[model samples]
Target: MRRKQDKNIENKQREEETIPKKISYAEILELKKPDERKLFLRKTFLLIGLILFVLSIILFVFINTLVGLGLFLLSIWVISKYWTLQDHLLRESVYFHPKYQEFRETPTKKIQFFNFSFSRFIATVIMISLIIWNINTFGLELGHVGDTGHWWNLGALTWAYPLAIPLAILSLGLVGYIVIHPNLTIIYESENLYHIYEIRLFSPWLTEIPKNNIEAIRLHNSKNGPQWLYAVILFYIILLFKSGIALIEHPFQTNYIHSVHLIITASLTLLSIIILIAKQHCYFEIVTSDRLYEMWFDPALLHKRKMENIANFFCIEPIARDQHGFFDPLPKKSVNYDDQTRELLISTSRSYFRLCFGLFLIFIGIYSIFSYSLLGEFTAYTCLSYGFIVFFKGIKEDFSDKNNIIIEIDRENKQFKQKRIFSRILEYHFFNNLKSLQLHENTDKSPQYYPPKLDIFDIAGVIAIIFFIVQEYVYQIMVWAPKNIDFQNILVMLFELSIIITLIYLIIRPVDTINVGTKTIDNYIIQLPSLFRYSEKNGERNNFILSNVYKSKETKSFIKKRIILIIITISISAIIAVIDIFQFLP
Candidate 1:
């Protein structure tokens, strides 16, 4: 009798442990009633649109150049009204599956979204053909630039062709990768494991996250919601400044016919800005403890109701959080850790990758700005502005808030990973935001304004940059003097210098442990950063080294793989940029 009772109790406990925290959908999903504020907004937009339309007509009869500005404002108002109405309708009722009425525990549920659109297919075909055509064109150009031809008299043409070949090849390679890549794949298994694969075309490579290592599954909106706003502001500021200058200089003497084109251009630019702002809110992300999976919506595809419906059907919990958006219906953790391990403060190695890349971009931008080509100046300005923004952001993070630290422990691999203090926001649009998840010691004190410490790798990078600049300066001076200078010695010296710097950096920045004296701390509230990190003390009575023995080989292997990938990417970009902007013939 006693044995049977004990078995029953054990089974009940296991069942309880398996069950997720129950949440009522009705309680969370509120049917928003028609409010006065919404009504006011609707009316206000309609009024503005009407007024703008009337004003545009008046302007068209008088100052034709001003008509376009009026029309653009009217169009914006109309679009805003449409969006507001759409949102209101979507909030009226919860669009949910009948299955959601009763939560059923399924062994596995997989949602695969394959975005093979007709337009994308057409684009891929065009790109492939263009690449082939360019490759052929480049070969001809290269032949023309040979000693037999007057390539020197061609000046910029000579340099442009040589630069074009590599750029074309790089583009072709990237396009091919994108065309073959899968859109998005999500698989949720009974073992609390999520298998997610998200591949976008512009991304250099596909990321296949290792299975069963997810500590937490969350869905959130991206943090880059404001960067788009900044871009729009800059666009308008430039536009207004140009328009004001033109008006002052020309006045009534402004040619109405010629100004029509300018108006059209301005109108299109405004429309684009609106679209850009709208698109910023279109992203929904599924963040694992380690990996982040993001998907962009057309806004037309799934309304708020439909999105929630999909979430509910998939057993996802809907969450509304500030800073970043997280979805609901979190899966139960596959592996459970002791309470003590969870309490450990974690930190990751501070990789100055973003800083270095930003500096490289600024350098390129400066070069382009000075190159004195119209197109170069415009492109350079954009790059310089963005570089400054990123550079400042890195500084802010390093100085102020270090919000991206999280405690990530992989029981399967017996490895712990954490992002650095000043990690870049993972929410990326153009390129893949891959962070090297390396574990490091966690500081016991609160985030402090510590003096900047230059790492060995940073010094190496600076030295390389100095060498390149010095070599370029010398070569340029020689070229301007109309003298034939042999660059073979300089090239060899630069190559040797680079090799030595790289070796020194590697030797100094080895995978060895550091012994910064440790201290014992009593129980304190631990808040995780936006990203992942896990720290374990190296001393005695360190009850913190989470339940499992740290396997150095596994951790080192993981770190090495990520480091190699980053190095390869940086090297390729640097090579292409250097070739593209070769200023002197030496």
Candidate 2:
């Protein structure tokens, strides 16, 4: 009986695993003829071309006349081609999927109202206010006979002031139109589930998902804080440019420019506030499943196919105490989702705009360095110093690998050895025994995991030497002196050289030891006198003595070297200083 039950369950599972067939577009457009679709595309193309042509004409007439007119016609031609290509692609897509139909048979009533009222009102208000402000401040200049000492006196502002406002208004209106349009739709249907999307002019349309198609549903944050901040800064800069133009055109009309500035500043400031509010509310949430995922921002939401998604979902783990009663591990878990998902978040966050802003800043920095005489040398020195230090540190660490030596004592013999081991050595032993040895691997723990051969003092000395060299070069290039180099500079250089030499000697010294066995013995009792002392009594081992050999002969040699170098360095510095002082006095 149990066997029969298990067989039934297995059969049911197999039946449930069947994949659903996708719908085709040809079935969807069967209600309308091919000729009608072609006609509709033609009209859309013509409309788009006409709009582009009109915009071009207006811009051309207002700006450079002939050049404007030429560009205007060219833009119209380009827009026409763009529309035709878009139409062709859309038709091709629809033909390939005949069964696939739009989610909505008719446009939503809410969208129509939004388009006619809210969008139009906002656009009109913005357009009218901009026109009024520009005319009152800059338009008056065309009729004025005398110079008003305004930025209108400048050629660029004179041309830009009239063109920018209308263009901005037009862009806003277009965005609004895209949001409100209702004919566009997306449909998703499965064996048991159905999804429908009514596409508006403002955002992409999405369809419903089949329950079986969903693999797993997970939450994701799409907002990139850094990218958002960069975008805000960029917009602020653009507004500042507009304000600059206004300032140039009407130098005396501070009130008009100030108002414009206030408006732009307020809008941007409000946007930042909104972003902060959203972050507090966790406004960026993405619901991802196997078949599809939906990204929801405050004002907009989008759904994309699972195959077409690309996003980086960071899995943030909450703080937890380990068995050792210590809270240490805190790391974000991350995975790369599909590219479509990533792009969706990136587009909404205005990540590309942020990148452009970064590029702009880099260009500005470069320009400032080259164009400003006062900053040229300082910038050059700073960049050179940073580059040299980083390069030297990398090279020193790489070369110091040869200095690392690991000695493994037999487990049985470890009890016989007696030495006051340094804390560093103890740590090295603990890590080597407890954790897997990571020599060349660049893992998360690599930075903390010290290689066996490299000594701490050697590393420190190398760093110090690099710093001294860099400083010496900088002094040579920047500071001017008499026929003889400055005594202070010479002193600094000599002191650095002395330290480097001392460090080198300390690193190269051999390990000290003493043998305790007779000449005939093959395995002599090798006693490391610096670290340990063992006594043999009645042919048996007695108490083992331990010593801190690190501070003995090897350390003394290093210290002596340092002292000698310091004295020599000081003498050289003193001689140079005396020469410099005498030369000045003469």
Candidate 3:
């Protein structure tokens, strides 16, 4: 009886433990499946907001101002509720119990200063201050005259205020959301011989692979990070300058002092440029065996490379410094690398190119503003010539990859086929019998696959070609044709026709190449060939094979040609401008 009683107690305890475990597992599952209740609440609020906004507009048109104002306020409340609910849903989705596991294992000592709670608090405070200032200045404009001690007699405020205020609020919210959201961080645990992917919103996933899987691991400067700040600043300055110019031309007949505005605008632009340059230099990447890790102006880059008994690798640190003031220097920075090689240092070269292009565009805009007719004619001719050059170059490179090895993999049948290609029209079949095709590389020994012949006078191209051909004809007709046709009228019609044709062709031309893939009905069968490459045995001549199409030097040469063509086009335009100016001289 004692033994039975002890067994029963043990069973009861086990049952109690199992019940909680099952309940906890169920809760986790529910969390994983997206919170539908929050979504539904958000949808309800959105619908209510939309209805209120529409009703407010109708009430404003038919009823009194008080009813319209009340409805508008109600709409705003509904919209705010919708946004709050949506944000709550995102937070719930991104912050689950499982996600905290990653932080638990990572050493607290390695955490960067910027990643701390204090840094986030400071950023949030600054953002909030900016928001408050913007609202005080712009939100007051939404109210009626004397509503907020501001008098504005713009009748468009009824619609504009509602739309613009919400847009501004949404924009600010999006920026905050992006800043707060955690990004996926991949860490190389050399000791484990595996890659650790700490997904920002989820538990870490680990993948183990042989050393051969890693092609190279190197610390290179992030192309996007530093330049993004400058791009944003430049874009903002350009917009502001354009706005200021417009305002100066058509002075806003308001109480605001125009002189004060001009001074403010100039100061803002100067400050923005300086801040933009400062931010550009503080970005670097911490590359690992499997993925590129961007470590932005962080101290992690300064740490010495550590190699453990388990994972042995070298680190390559790629650094770029500003010399000769070609462009703004990125903030002084370095990042630790583990078993990686730096491929190239590109900061200075890319900056120089970007600066030159921007200045060229600005010069063109200025010239166009001053001498519209001459610049217009020269621009038209230059664009036409460049388009033809690109079309021919694309064809030439496409035809160059003819003889190379093609490896086609059939996933379904677990079979692979290797073939030597001699022509551009070669085809391969996957083991699952799906038609897998690729263009082989062009080589010296094989005939190249020429691009499909495009009709030189295809509808739009015909129009462009005819426009230039008939321009002289139109000029002649104006002098020799019937009295009913006015000379200037004919010339104008010809110009308009040419412009329309050129615009249509420019709009329709494919800016980049297209890739095609084939899948079986079951979706289990998939096949594709590896990239094309030149065969050493083929006398080093280039031909186009499906696999080697993009890897060829011909492709690089083509890109170089396009760039050179652009330079030549610009030079030609300048020369034409000089000639035109000389003709116009008294």
Candidate 4:
């Protein structure tokens, strides 16, 4: 009986050792009601605070600068108090203490929610981005000209000075709103559910993932030590190379540029090297897959032991590692993707139409603006319209997330799917039914599987073509056409009609490339930036489906014509501008 009891005790200890550490943030915090109402109040306060802060800055610009400063400080103080109050409410909850990371353990000895706090990494990013984006604008507006006649807009006394206060408020408001939200990566209690809870102003955003569905947990460190160190060293070496060049080029010319470069490079080299990495901001991730999920994370966040326990608890197969002992970046498409199926991440697509149109509009706008209002009101209106057009188009291109397309190719199922982020539609096709995919470089946006759409740019092109045709026709009728009713007049009229038809064709060129009535198979067009850098080949852009399609003859022909047109148009307009006002810049 004693021996049996000892064996049972040993078994119990083994079971205890095997039991995975599961964290339940909600249960541990004893959160009862949905925090939506609470969050609503918090969001309202933040919005109001931001507006007031901006108002103070505006007041500062109009009134005395000191008055504006005082008001802004007051607004800032009020906002800070409100944030502190909001955090106080979060901390005062029954289970969670104000101190930080309070947790409650279950009877089974499972410790739930070791702790959750605001992410310092996120806060740091917000601060950095705000400073970088607004610095130039501030310099442009508020800065005074140097004694040597060097000028900048550095917020000196311009109306833009007021804008800085509001911008600061906006930045702080955003950081407070987002960074103060708790980070809950994974929380699980029983066999029934697993969840990731992020507390936001909207409420607790809880994504409950089923137990069997979770494939693997991997680590990603934002502050990659070795990579950062290498970059800093490379930057210093480049600076050193430049200094050497400067010494060779102007050995006796002492304007402080050479000395500045050398001093900065030398000062940073050692410090960047020996900051000996610590406290990484880590993101644990895995591709959302129906099969075994593959992920890689920093070992600091979830060590091998924790990974093994989690895998065992969830009944997941041990994540396979490559020969170098690193997790395989691309998970096998098959149970063993040896030969049956192949998955490829489609990377890099640029819209040549957008590019060409953007450049074309900017060219037109510059010419109109600098034409000295030669066409009077017509030139003024055109210049005004183009200003808005150029600004909006730039914002749409540079700031927008065009890389939200996710494609999945299931060779086993003979299926091709294109799914976009935040989109409900799943566009799919049969693999054998599809024939070709256009592969284009990032700089080469002319190649596309489908014809481009008709937009304002197309209309503008048509209008310009028509205007030129009209001008030519008027010139011919007044100067070249004989003042007699004869066969020549009929021929002239026919020529004008032909010009209209040609202009119409040019207007619809982008749209007419793809004939809807044709039975040709389409190549899936996936647009990305720096395609291979974040590709299935390198293993970074793992969330999307993958395929690498070589350039096709049909696509190539279309792209070649389109590119030649872009080039010719750009060259012609650029030459005109150079003659018209290359002085526009100087």
Candidate 5:
């Protein structure tokens, strides 16, 4: 028996010169989803955020009374308007689709995980183990249970026997369920249709997209912040380790074979360093007409046969940038547009973890300042502006240079149309006019020590001068100082030296540039710091150019001059070193 086709589905099939089994509903209606762009939430995060938010409101209201009322209303407005954390879209319990005639269809294939896996279970266990390890890193005294002595270590759960133990037990149940099930995906497919079923903690509902509705599949690297920051962190960790060893100058090599807390902190730092080294940028992105599906995986570990199967099954090519993050372009004689304009849909959605963290920090900072710290003292120093800085950084991920885009390339008409929905930006260009435009790509050498905010050498000179100055005073005066003072002062002086060294190290970092400009146009260059690649035919591109990451010289000379600081610090240091060596000064 033949299935009935809906109007919208029928029309799509008819255009492609093929007919599909009909359905009662004409068009596949996409359910309205949560505004996931602004806020962040996963399984248990929303509850935690809600509790923190309530606590903050209570503290403010109790203290400010009248003013707190207005602040509360403002908070409500702000949260609702922008960053109100919400849960993932929970799909309906059931769905309507083509009948389950798996045996009847030709070449009916069911593809998913090669087998059930405990990878997720293992990862979850490791994460929870780390959490418990850190929890016990510091000393704690849990209150006594009846006449019993204080609970120690893992026994701390007994203090809150009523709620804590119950909650812990409930958490264990959830973890057990997750460990058993993990996340599963099953895609049932034939020559004409694809039915996808995803079983995840957050994505429990199963559904499918129309086969013809699939627009494109893109591959992206999860590259992060500037190189300078990475270098700084690496050096800082090394310096800290050195400092710790210096603190225990005695024979204590095996003491910490160290604190559990120090071990925990070191483990976290090492994890961060490992992330810095292995930048996991490979995510296979599948964009449908109305929705997007993503699989974040390490490309190196992805099965080659499976990847080929996906490509062959979809009847489409996967678009990815070259290692440098550029794309191969298309030729002049592109597909005949006829009466059709090949439309390209591009996504600019980013991870929202930072944005959520920033908002949470703002709430915590406000509560801390209002409840405990003096408003007058805080206002005077203004040192707590970091919360705002983090907030801005978080938002930057969303409102970056490249917004979600829809492009129509009419090579037949030699025309191009670009539009961004959220930004309401529209532009028109011509392919012929762009013929002379070469894709401009530039990359820097390996990451170095400092940012390109200023000249790196100048910063170095300044540090040198400051170090000599601090040392000269110590050398000249330490003759009369006690042994303890001398030792302590030397440590303090080295500490001061490290700070200056970092300051200059940051100033002198290299900054390469990437830009898009036309020789035919005026002095116009749009920096492509955030742009990975551009091509006329995005899906089936041929000619190519790309970059992974690039820092610009544009912001390097913001202050324009570091000469005075460099010259003064360097000259003073050099003169003192020379004089001391020659014993020219007493």
Candidate 6:
């Protein structure tokens, strides 16, 4: 009877909810108004082209070759603007429709396939630069070094001719790619679906993923760095470019160290280029149960609003589930003095994967120091530091004794004495704490069962960032001055080391938890401890742990007030920022 009554209540509530208007097919296909800012940008671009063309002509007439070459870049910029404007118009026509959600379009929502991202532009520039370098280095020798020509006496250089020929051919191919790269950005979109064309100017082209086929959308941190191999590739590329330039400028005067550097650089650069050609950026992954589709995007484009818009059209939803089945509260395993009970000491054992990685890093560091490779030293220090942290985390969980957390039920004193691992002394608390255990619903973007503990995760993340900065600085110093150490460098190294120590302390610190009220003294009378005291008053003893998840009334109230103030401050700041940006825009 109660279940039936609840069903009736739910049905009534559903009926009372506001109904969305039924969308028609025609309405779904209808376009909305053009964005005012985009329209203004379109006109401004056209005006700039006219001005630049006239300016280019004047410069060509006044100055000779140097300034005339600038026109080529100016023309590309003008054409790129027209392409961008075309994309903005397409988005306005299809995406802005109010009823477009009814069409169920999949993501990739391509405005233009030919549209260039910042990374793409950077890649194109790198390719062009490399082609020029190759030409300067090997082009002339391979083209004219034959037995019948004035280069007939250059037969002594014949040993390198075979290798140079293939190298020159590869350079020519790279140049050809740049010429054709611009043509790949085709626009493909409709009211129902849209997709970006996967173009490979320097990298492998991704296969097209149809909108109707995608079963789910996965989000990633836009700021996450590229793969470790890719990072190594970038580092080597820099080294190669520097050495190659030095060789080209003064081939005969270069030292043995410079020669070795050039050879190593060239080999690494070739390997890196091959990797770049084979690897595609694994950004937004469109997942079906059976397959995955990966694509990269500008970080600014992956806004929450845009993601939600995509989700609405695709008829897809974010995956969130209680996969761990922690719905019921259970006591975590208690640690004891005996090593025989180590297996039951903690609910979960922290994996040693990171610790192993750290050890590998230490090996790399030792090798680097022996080889006098500064970059290797940086990698070693950073990795070893992180490795020891996770190693100790495992150690603490494995070896922690009962004294790590002491929960004393003092019946005569009508108090509880709680001592956690990191605390200097025990905290004395009166019994009479109230409220039942409460667990907040946790949802993460990744496929995780539980929310991460923010304290540890947040600190580790900050340390990683600091180490990255330190690593970069160390690399810079090694390149500029191998032996000299500046005061600033010493300070940075110290700071980096200090963070490692802090990480070790945090990782090994015993986690203290209880299953009672997180309330203050005022709400203590209404808490579960107060109810437990009733049994104590009747000459019975019950020992229990409290859940430390809830905030006290006073704390919650204070936090609420502060949050309101912060929201208002942020609102005012955002409005001011927007106005300032608009004022500077033409």
| Cα-based lDDT for every prediction | 0.38, 0.34, 0.36, 0.38, 0.39, 0.38
The clash numbers for all candidates, in the given order, read: 20, 34, 35, 24, 21, 15
Alpha-carbon shift of residue 57 in model 3 (angstroms): 32
- Looking at candidate 5, the ten consecutive residues that score lowest on lDDT are 424-433
- lDDT, candidate 6, equals 0.38
Please provide, for model 5 over 1-586, each residue's C-alpha lDDT reduced to its tens digit, 9 standing for 90 to 100.
Answer: 1344577677877775443343222233322345364234332344454554575588676766656566556555544533333322222222323344221123357766432223333433544554465344432345334322223344453322321232244336537755444455566674543556656653433444445544444433322323113323333333334444443554644444233333344445545433433342223545454556665432223444444445445533322222443422322222344534333434343434435544543454344344543122222112123223334333432333343433334444333333222221111121222222212322322111112332342343235435544444455354434444566656645654554454443344222211212223322222111223334335342222222222334333432345455656656766665667568445
Per-candidate RMSD, Å: 22.6, 22.5, 16.8, 17.0, 16.7, 26.2
> In model 5, what is the error at residue 15, expressed in angstroms?
28
TM-score of each: 0.30, 0.29, 0.34, 0.30, 0.35, 0.28
Query: C-alpha displacement of 43 in model 3, angstroms?
Result: 30
Predicted structure 4, TM vs. truth: 0.30
Q: Residue-wise lDDT of candidate 2 within 1-586, one digit each (tens)?
A: 9999999999998785443344444543342233555657667767777776787777767766787677677767765654444332222222222235443222222111111223333434554455455455545444334232333454334322543454355446545654553334343334333343443444444444333323222222322222222222323333444454555567566445444544554354334323332231011222222223443322222221111121111111111222332321111111112211111000000012223322433343334344542223333233222222222222221121211212222122111111111111110110001111111112222111111132333343234333434444444434443445777757645654554454343333323232112122222222121211222222121222223233334336655664565456445544554555566653
Q: Which stretches of model 4 miss by more than 4 angstroms?
A: 1-36, 39-95, 98-237, 244-282, 286-586
Taking the tens digit of each residue's C-alpha lDDT, what string does model 3 give over 1-118?
9999999999999886454221233332343344778778888998999899999988988987789989999999998887664322112223333434332122211222122122
Tell how far residue 211 is off in model 2, in angstroms: 4.7
Q: How close is candidate 5 to the true structure, as a TM-score?
A: 0.35
Superposed Cα deviation of residue 527, candidate 1 (Å): 16
Question: Candidate 1 residues 4-118, lDDT tens each?
Answer: 9999999999998577633233322221234566677777777777777777777777778576676967667685773545223112112323233322223355544444333
lDDT digits (tens) for residues 1-586 of candidate 4: 9999999999999998576545454543334233666667666767777887998889888877887788788778766755544322222212332135322221221212222223333433543453454344334333565321222243245322332343355346545644444333334444434444443343443333433233323332322322222222323333344453555457565455434434443343323322222223233443222322222232334433443344344333222222343322223221232344544443223334434444553454344434532222332233233333333333332122344433444445333333222111111112222232223233231222323333454445445444444444443454446565467656656754564464343332332111111013233233232223234355553222222222345544655665556446545644554444434535
Q: Could you tell which candidate, 3 or 6, scores higher by lDDT?
A: 6
Candidate 5, residue 352: the lDDT equals 49
TM-score for candidate 1, please give it. 0.30
Quality of model 4 by C-alpha lDDT? 0.38
Q: Residue 52 of candidate 3: its Cα lDDT? A: 95
- Model 3: residues with Cα > 4 Å off, grouped in runs: 1-131, 138-153, 158-188, 191-212, 225-239, 243-314, 317-354, 363-586
